[model samples]
Target: MQINGAQMVIEALIAEGVDTVFGYPGGAIMNVYDEIYKQKDFKHILTRHEQAAVHAAEGYAKVSGKVGVAMITSGPGFTNAVTGLADAYMDSIPLVVISGQVPMSLIGTDAFQEIDAVGISRSCTKHNYLVTKAQDLPRVLKEAFHIAATGRPGPVHVDIPKDVTAEIAEFDYSIVLDLETYKPHVKGNPRQIKKVMEAIANAKRPLFYLGGGIINANAAYEVRDLVQKTGIPAVETFMARGVLSCDDQLLIGMLGMHGSYASNMAMSETDLVIGLGVRFDDRVTGKLSEFAKNASVIHVDIDPASISKLVNADYPIVGDVKNVVNEMLELIAGIESQKYKVWRETVQNFAKLHPLTYHEDTERLKPQWVIQRVGELLGDSANISTDVGQHQMWTGQFYPFTRPRQFISSGGLGTMGFGFPAAIGVKAATPEKISINFTGDGSILMNVQELMTAVGNKLPVINIILNNNYLGMVRQWQTLFYDKRHSETDLSVQPDFVKLAEAFGGIGYRVKTKEEFDSALKDAVEKNVVAFIEVIVHRMENVMPMVPAGGSLFNMMLLEKKGEK
Candidate 1:
């Protein structure tokens, strides 16, 4: 039963049911990499960079609904993954990042490749530890996985010194995790659940605001049941997209800054706002004071600290999203049927009047048209990941997601280089799923080297590039508010993206016209290799229904001019 810490690490991963690991090996972590090489249980994906490794793990986690595991060396390797840690932290993704540290004896001797792994990752991780003793490997690794996948899940870091990996220890892969301070509240408080049920029963214009927590808690079915039983309208945030189908009668679409007009308007007019696993972030709330101002908020979250952290909740229920929703549904069963005929009519009118629309051009391909066609062709089955900016918004707005975890993107972090690498992770984890990265020209270049990673690993992912020759999102802001001073935003002298893809050992296509795009996209999808299709879209086509920073969601910039549409 005696094993080295490196073997303990692999054993712990196997015990935790971790089948895949995304990482780049380095000298410090070479022992763990050696141990990884000896095992066929865990599939180790060698990403091009440490950042992409973390992102690939994120993609795997998002799709597989499992705790993502990443391994890297100290110093630059750890630092490279900091962005990914922060991104996962911001979006509450469950991840366990194992970093190799220098020997314990060289702690303060300024050892080579030795930076404070726990110190650097402290802010970004939910919890972190530096393991010096070899015997403590099993316990720490077990706790790390538990913490990463537990309540209000986020990244957890475990720093293993190089010497510890060589030390022998009796490795018992037991599940006796006795961390007294780390218990998550999974059951809803009865009194708070009663209040939510009462509110649901009484309110004529009640609205449910769902967040990433719904998907994180795996409570989509409970949310659907609650919405169906109560007949209440629901709107999802960017992180919680696809909780309900776009065509669901009770659904109003995604809400917040770039939210649908109907969804925002409904939020503005509601009397009761049921916050389900949502943090009520600023981007989603726009002007805080004006956000659901007239509504009595009932916030339900597993993390009690999240309650009233931003917007004060009249009824704060601290429990798991699915558990709380299930309890509420059970409590409200057989209650008198509630109707919001007038409110529904008002919301429908809002939808009809201010529908999500964009200018279509026959001569030039618009971004909206491209996204719509992709949705039409692929349907809602493809695993869609996106880098932040115009393409991110377009995917969220246009894609009709019916299943949970169907659309993945950088939500809280708004990370630019997230899409392609994440698609690689998604494809790696779920090879059967058609994974695609819907990205923009500017965002794609951030970590385009990962194209080689995908091709090398034989992870056939499709990257659809919306080439607009400018930082489209920033240009939109400049055009509307900054008097068209498009300083430093022009990316006209960019590399040929088609050639860039081909250079990375992937199939590349340039499509300017709609017909060409359709043909090229179909061809790319059918190809059993990494493919990139660069679709030339108009630079001036802006993502519409914009809510300027700090502006009330009600007061949106619907169009450039009165008669423009």
Candidate 2:
């Protein structure tokens, strides 16, 4: 059967089981959009911007556990999505971004909207290609999806020249991909697995260090089982928030710079660290020398290079997190859960002594209270996305996340304009559940335009704006370290967020007190429209239990001293 490249592109998407695609059409990619117009098999969402398109795809992927697909034109269209590509790459989110290139004849001739899509995306994308021949679409599309969704999943780019989209070719549906250079090892070695189990069994203060890879591998159940069976006190990184429920007894809490005191202390004093699918990032490790200094590290990851990229592993198991954890479960009978009772008590003591605490006030609305209230109201019934900064930390601390893929944020890239658009994507993927975007005043403005996208598409996502009237996180650093010399972080001259929401054809509410907040939130829930609730919070309040950069995890600024400044 003969078909054009544009038709083949849509066909390939259908064959790959892609149900929804997020994108913005432009001059170079007009043909693909035209083909999209005729397709009924999949739905295409026209986001407000290309960046939103990519971020929405990321949110969709995070929740669906499927490869997210996005399309855009060459040059600025692809460039606009760079941040999202980098974010997806850092978080190991599988995505396929299709870009329309200039005609092959225009290569190196500086044609309109022409740029090196492959070159610019090479550093961020796991793999990329330039397709000039129409007949080559099948193999490239197949390989793109395969590479994007395989081990250590990441974004893949496929740039199809404009001429190729119009070129007629023999379209064969079945083509076996010959990917000799790309193969991911999925099973751990028996010897390494045995050694890891032995270390967990014998260590007096064993700690399970969880990361996002467990969620990526869909191994939350495996990890939870291993933790329960071994009775090891576990601590999660930011991206691993819901792998172990916030209420899980075996879980201490999130461990990192903004981590709970107990979680950080446990990481500091543990005798053994059983890291599953973790990257040992700087935010989590604090000072490398002082981090888990007394502990023997057992790192399990599918990517071999990530094993010792920062902290050297004593026992490195190269395999899928699910596969390795399942192997450990087979040997769980050999380990005794009673041996670590004392260690668990010590961790619990740390939690009691200096927990993730904040000062509560009656006259003013604290950011923590807002988050806690939302968690109490929704629990695991809602999907939450957040932009970077104080609000992101607050969500990590207070949200009662009980399921994998329930919490979405930019962990590695920490992109600011990620939350609202991502919430739109989340709502698109799971229309049955409520999607909420917890964003700060500064962070929300970065992509506030996406409210129009939500409104236009009729996605009743709830955008909870913790409007503190400052770049809250940066202000904290200034208060603590910069001698209160607050440079330009003050966002006092901000737009009326509620009015801004209405301008985008959405409902809005302004809450200055906790009492107002409750009613506003309830109203938003009942309205079930694209809504934004701007809750005015204390401007100077900060994320607590902070371990300053390069400081030991054990040393945290527990509480603000009254009248210290």
RMSD of 1: 1.2
lDDT of 1 by residue, 1-27 (tens): 899999999999999999989999997
Q: Residue 527: error of model 1 in Å?
A: 1.1
Off by over 4 Å in 2: 561-565
State the TM-score for model 2: 0.99
Note the Cα lDDT for every prediction shown: 0.89, 0.92
Which ranges of candidate 1 are over 4 A from the true structure? Answer: 334-338, 560-565
- In model 2, the worst 10-residue window by lDDT is 556-565
- Residues 250-323 of candidate 2: C-alpha lDDT, one tens digit per residue: 98999999999999999999999999999999999999999999999999998999999999999999999999
Per-prediction TM-score to the true structure, in the order listed: 0.98, 0.99
Decoy 1 TM-score against native: 0.98
